[model samples]
Target chain A: MPHDHHDHDHPAHSPPQPDDKVHSYYQILGVALKELLIEKGIVTADEVRSAIEKRDQITPAHGAAVVARAWSDAGFRTRLLTDANAAVAELGYPMTTTRLVAVENTADVHNVVVCTLCSCYPRELLGLPPAWYKSRAYRARIVHEPRAVLAEFGTQLLEETEVRVHDSTADMRFLVVPRRPAGTESLDEAALAELVSRDSMIGVAVVRQP
Target chain B: MRGPHDVGGLDDGPIDPAPHELGFWEKQIDGLRGVIGAKVIVTTHENRRYVESLGDDAYETLTYYERWTAALSRQMVDKGLLTQAEIDARVRVVRERLAASGELAPGAEDVKP
Candidate 1:
């Protein structure tokens, strides 16, 4: 009875809201002091730096390659749509944490991803998510009004593409593998990578012709 | 302390908290610190008068920060900056150094107990 009363009183006396500013990305990704010391023993600072650089260079290209292949190869597209993890690995970007879910932006429903629980991004393929992608405004609004959220990012989907909001919970994360843009029929893998921004993969932006 | 996930509709604005560019693990640590700080101050203030009504239990209830600091020290150790032995040694040294200097209050060292 006492515990129940405590729980009841909790909601009635919650504090006023806090600030809306997001934490800085560098502060977010910086190694803990302990980890930094441990890392010095295990690997050189230069080595760690090089590893990060290589990871950054490869993942976006790898993701674009998958998108390009998916555009051309029917079987690969099927595999990507059906099993995003295996498809991503097939293209050589094997992400350990994120569970890849390709939300097809079609004439019907367009899928957008937001981690209401935490920032569960597809870093293995897309690299780091953009600053706005992780903002409190984006996280809270995307779920309720996907179209308006997308509009803020300068992405105006056709009215036909019904906005389907996907929230990343504790266990699983999602990525939106947007429908390949039209007129990109002739572009190569390298060219395609230029068009695939991190925001696009989150379903907030779309690849447009240059 | 507020949970990282509890920042929605904050500051009377509709904007979402921008995601910091840090990697997942780093963000978790920051979130942990925020949560702990929020919990301690809120709890202490909320129960201050209640503790005055029940002296010993109130003191016991106010030991939240001690538990959190201990957990944070353990986390630092687990992350590999310090060994368990080092943390224990550091805690002992800090206690002794403080006590020898008369910095320890009448019951401060007994907070953990």
Candidate 2:
């Protein structure tokens, strides 16, 4: 008699085991120091470690630089529009390993990003993705129906604002460079960077004048 | 050759008695090939019956698999084994197959390769 015994035998191959390591919530960002330690003897380990350290040190400064450039230089903004990665690199904050796509939120189009898979993020450029960003609720809901998800995050866009939801699949990731808010025209670049929370980059929160 | 139960701690984290976590029996069934593939399909299905059978937790887990499959499909497309159109077609086909089989529940459709 022909039976599905081959299928039956499959599950019997291995038994369930318990996961003892309670992963640190922060480790999900892949910025944890231990990853560097594990790669100590490897060729690129030193560079990776240095890159992570540099990323942590310069995230705020990078934000400031972008804001400053936008405020002062029209050409820089155009360059940012054309190739954000290169523009950021020219400013001395090159994204490491992670490919970055800067989604520009304008009067017509609003952009939101989510890593529906294992969190592929632009840690070098945007720092860590917030805890909510990595949550199962956000991961499952965002890509399917983004407007509803953004509403949950307290960002309500006008009907005229086209919502572009960019799904961060495997290799590439994204960050939202929101349009400069109206009231913030008076504030300097440093002040503007302070208002740019990680959530703003993820497109959950808009940068507001402080 | 890897059993679904074996993957528990490796990927699923610590076990709990809650119905949300896959139990021993559930893991056994999930280790079967058809169940994994069908669960992947159920996530993409819009049909109410297929959606309801997946339950909330299973649907969430399946989302991870869907991402995995999407990445794999993209890679396959890039490598020329399939095209983007073909991958989209496969996703539609898989969804239809799962919906018709009435095995949208976790581990309900375990088939041998």
Off by over 4 Å in 1: A1-32, A35-55, B1-4, B7-74, B77-113
How far is A124's C-alpha from truth in model 2 (Å)? 1.3
Predicted complexes: DockQ each? 0.09, 0.03
lDDT of 1 by residue, B11-41 (tens): 3224442444444333444334433333342
Compute fnat per model.
Answer: 0.11, 0.00
Report how far off residue A1 is in candidate 2 (Å): 33
Q: A24-62 in candidate 2: lDDT tens per residue? A: 111111121222223433114444344445434645446
**Each candidate's interface RMSD:** 13.9, 18.0
What are the lDDT figures for the candidates, one per model? 0.53, 0.48
